[model samples]
Target: MPRHGRLHIPGGCYHVMGRGLERRRIFYADADKQDFLDRLGETLARNGSQCVAWSVMTNHYHLLIRVGDQPLAKLMAPLLGGYAGHYNRRHHRSGYVFQNRYKSILCDADAYLLELVRYIHLNPLRAAMVKNLTDLDRYPWTGHSALMGHRKQDWQSVSEVLGLFARGLGTARRRYREFVVQGLEERDSDELLGGGLVRSYGGWEGLKRLRKEHVYCIGDERILGDSDFVERALAQDTLKVEQATQRIQAGWDLDRLIRRVSQYCGIKEEQLTQKARGNDLSLAKALICLWGSQELKLSLREIAHRLSISQPAASQWVNRGRKFCRELGIEFEVIDS
Candidate 1:
């Protein structure tokens, strides 16, 4: 089936999840878990993104993050690709690393923040990892511990979730624990997880009303929480990519692109950071690097020196420039054209 769509927005908050194909175990040992977390940390840092909550299970993982200005495609490209490659190499395995494209739900922070926080924090308990309330309080994989002010990691921005609860961290933890305890005892109910209108409402009647009103953003019935959140998040993500791509094609580089890259694109010096790759981006980068070596009167050795790429690789990039131009269906103009 063609995909339904995606939800996305600048500064959108999302609850993201990925499961293994056929429900297979993706992490079999401690090293696998640690490596995955390491990748998570690096990706968030490198991408200039923030992670609110996350947990790694044997076959699935959960994350709550706020999307920055960069489209999910570009932002996730390096993070997911890099981690998949590393994991495959280390495990001596090949083929797909994650199931499908993964799920990202765009949540209205004001309405759903506390509920979603509870939902994510209690994931381990829902899986029976902790067995009891006492055990869940300290479950290491979740941001719940950090929210309680018991375990703090700078990477997990607790303020957003923490702010929703009054009575401070200690009081919040006690109340939150009770909430999760009740939630675990009640996960069987469709109403609690599948909210209506907002992440807070419940009941079939409420959902029926939402549907009647032509509401979107409902979540998958098979999964818990609001489906509308997922729907809207995916849509916004697609839109963002389109807009960023248009800006790049229009020759307006907002990120002050590298001079060498500008010379290569023949548009301006800012297209490199315009966040629209599609086909043009890769070609532009390759062409720019190539022009630095070929037509600019810059020697391969000098080009390699300037770009910090090896002379052979630099020459190959230049050689690939024309081919890339043809492949992208872009006209080739000399450097500084």
Candidate 2:
């Protein structure tokens, strides 16, 4: 069966997982894990995303991220690709590093944020990589150490996670530790992993209960939430797709997009297509690249060719342009002639 497209909701939280190819070790040493974390930190900063919780196992890793305006792929592609490339070069080997595309589940933060955080942090302990909560507290491979005040990761959203527990930092840390300890006896659940009807309804028992009550609800493998939340998420995604389609149908071609972006950035249209770089010119090109790919559904190669830049450069511009547009409150609208 064909895979479904990822749900890209701005400001949404996700539980992301990636495994090494054939379940082999992705991080052969402490240095490898640190390298991956470094890339992750930089990626999160660049994309304005947050790492609420993360755990780096030998063969796999998990991240709970709250994305900014740009899509999760924007942050993930560079991080994963850069790390894979580094690993290959350092290990004197080549081929696919990861199993496949990383799995991400759009979570209902209000319902599952804290639970997910605890689940992620406890991974090391559950896997016997650490002896117990004490060992887990100081385990450098996960965000647990940072939250416990034993270590610091500037990229981890320490305060955000702590704040959910208490108004005061000290009290919050105490309560959060207590919460983590409470989860020690609980087995890993599919509900946390996320998927369609069974997982969404909290396993087969929950689904059977709903069935007996004659309650029918929506569920998607891409989302982790109640039926109402799932319905709303699907609706929002549908609306966005429809809007993009309408813009394309309304003749929002690359040339028109460039002209529009150039007009908005107060730069000449020719400047955007040139190799020169200036604040205004760069902004215009970035906007054009971003909108061309997103609104016009043009490929990065095409956008790069038109802007006199390489595909990689165009990808970077898309991210920069997304940040710029969000900061400037700019929206792409097709102006009728």
lDDT (Cα atoms) of all candidates against the true structure: 0.58, 0.80
Candidate 1 per-residue C-alpha lDDT over 245-288 given as tens digits, one digit per residue, 9 for 90 to 100: 44346563322224545555554544454543455555665665
Give candidate 2 misplaced runs (Cα > 4 Å). 1-3, 197-221, 240-337
Candidate 1 residue runs with Cα over 4 Å from true position: 1-5, 188-337
Least accurate 10 contiguous residues by lDDT in model 1: 220-229
Candidate closest to the true structure, highest lDDT: 2
TM for candidate 1 is 0.55
127-198 per-residue lDDT for model 2 (tens digits): 999888998989999999999999999999999888766668898899899989888877777788864333
Worst 10 residues of 2 by lDDT: 195-204
lDDT of 1: 0.58
lDDT at position 1, candidate 2: 41
What lDDT does candidate 1 reach at residue 282?
54
